[model samples]
Target: MAGLSSRSAVAIHALAMLANRREGSLTSAEIADSLESNPVMVRRVLGRLRDADLVWSTEGRGGGWSLARPPRNITLYDAYVAVEEGRIFSRHTRPPSGACEVGRNIGDLLDAEFQSAERALEERLDRTTVADLLQRILAADKEPADH
Candidate 1:
């Protein structure tokens, strides 16, 4: 039932912003302001990104966060794996009753299907980079020209 959580989305947004502003670092408060989110939440998401080596942080004066590598090198799949809680699709909370023939076979039968779907999703994610996302954002924000 659970899919990519808000943390994953926030991670992507934060990374995109960081990628766009490659010249300097940004505090979690500043990043959160850009995202219209809580600074604490931004810090938490950025912390996860930091742990994954997607972003790095500096403490104290002029301190903030910055992408560890170029945006083009960071795939969306990396962020997804960094913040998402579990698989794209999840099994039922309770194990199916093995006493029933259908229950006994359902997990095994659906596992391959779920795995295939996850692979498809990950493939799409792997194709999208933070640089690509920032480019799209920049393009969308551009003012239309008058003819």
Candidate 2:
């Protein structure tokens, strides 16, 4: 099945790390290190978060990012939408010269269906806050060692 963009996942992961840190601020390099990705990618995601007002960055030496508000106020939907530029699902071009009735309307029909599904997905995400995600991550980290 189709999935959320990798950028969405990466943004959430970065936010969760910030939420977990008692220090409340982390440099982009540190976030990149934890994500095992490049600092530029982390900064790009952070730039979007900053635009969304979900995160704030400091300048100069010891500069870093911090959540703009409490985790309980941010939803997964917020993080996802902040980075997504186009429609969640894109429609391919029309089929060759409307060869068949089905081909003619298929894109429109699929687009409608996708929009409906996306609405439901967004509603579910709205019910879950970043705080909930952080709790899950923390619980997983605390799981007992397996033999």
Candidate 3:
């Protein structure tokens, strides 16, 4: 099975960062730094997020990215859907030979399984929000005293 793209990861990370700084905004460069990525890459993903209405941006001085809605209102599924479009699992490009019983049935069976899995994934993701993720992230991090 093919895995989801890193664009989803970037969008989630950026969303959490924005949630953590709900009072302000973060430039694309700031987000890219956290991901060890480039500003353009961050911008591209953020642009998709913007289209989804999960985030908004500004221009000129102090220009940056900010959440369009409250963090609690933005589920991980929202971010996932914004960046990752279409199916994560793909069926065969061409239909299998109908002469073989196994080949004839496998495609439909696998597609049903894939659709079920995708639904499960979406359900799980829809349960968490950016605020939820940030809380978990902070709780899981090492404190200065531990360092």
Candidate 4:
């Protein structure tokens, strides 16, 4: 189904990194290093975030990226919406066969179902802010490992 893209993951990761290091700006290379990804990919994701005003950047030496607002103000859904290009669920590439009874009815039914599912996912994401996620991440990192 070609479900979701990795953009959301990258965006969320970058946001959490920024939240963790709130006092200073991070270069794309630095963020990328933590992600084990390249600077180009990090910059691409950051560009969308910048467009949404979730983060900002500056030019020249010693300048890079920083969050535009406090972590508490930015929700996961905000990052999702900023970077994702379309609905989480996709529809058929072409019209289903109108002559067939199942095909005729399936398109509308599937669309309604997919939209509902997408909305539910969005609502769940909206409940957690960057601050909340950072807290959970920190707590999780402190957990003892089982042998």
**Candidate 3 residue runs with Cα over 4 Å from true position:** 1-3, 142-147
Task: Provide the lowest-lDDT 10-residue window in model 1.
Answer: 138-147
lDDT of 4 by residue, 1-147 (tens): 667889999999999999999486999999999899989989999999999999999888989899999999999999999999877787788888999999899988998999999999999999999999999999998998772
Best candidate, TM-score: 4
Residue range 13-118, candidate 1, lDDT tens digits: 9999899885979999999998899999999999999999999999999999999999999999999998887787878789999999999999877878998999
- lDDT per residue for candidate 3 within 18-65, as digits (tens), equals 998947799999999999999999999999999999999999998899
* lDDT string, candidate 2, 23-73, tens digits: 748999999998999999899999999999999999988778999989999
Ranking by lDDT: 4, 3, 1, 2
Q: What is the lDDT of residue 15 in candidate 1?
A: 95
Q: Report how far residue 78 has shifted in candidate 2, in Å.
A: 0.7
Between candidates 3 and 4, which one is better according to TM-score? 4
Estimate the Cα RMSD of every predicted model relative to the unseen true structure. Answer: 2.6, 2.2, 2.1, 1.2
Q: Which scores higher on lDDT, 1 or 4?
A: 4
Q: Which stretches of candidate 1 lie above 4 Å from their native place?
A: 98-101, 143-147
For each candidate, give its TM-score against the true structure: 0.88, 0.90, 0.92, 0.95
Q: Kindly report the root-mean-square deviation of model 1 from the true structure over all alpha carbons.
A: 2.6
Model 1 per-residue lDDT at 113: 90
Clashes of 2: 0
> All candidates' lDDT scores?
0.91, 0.87, 0.92, 0.93
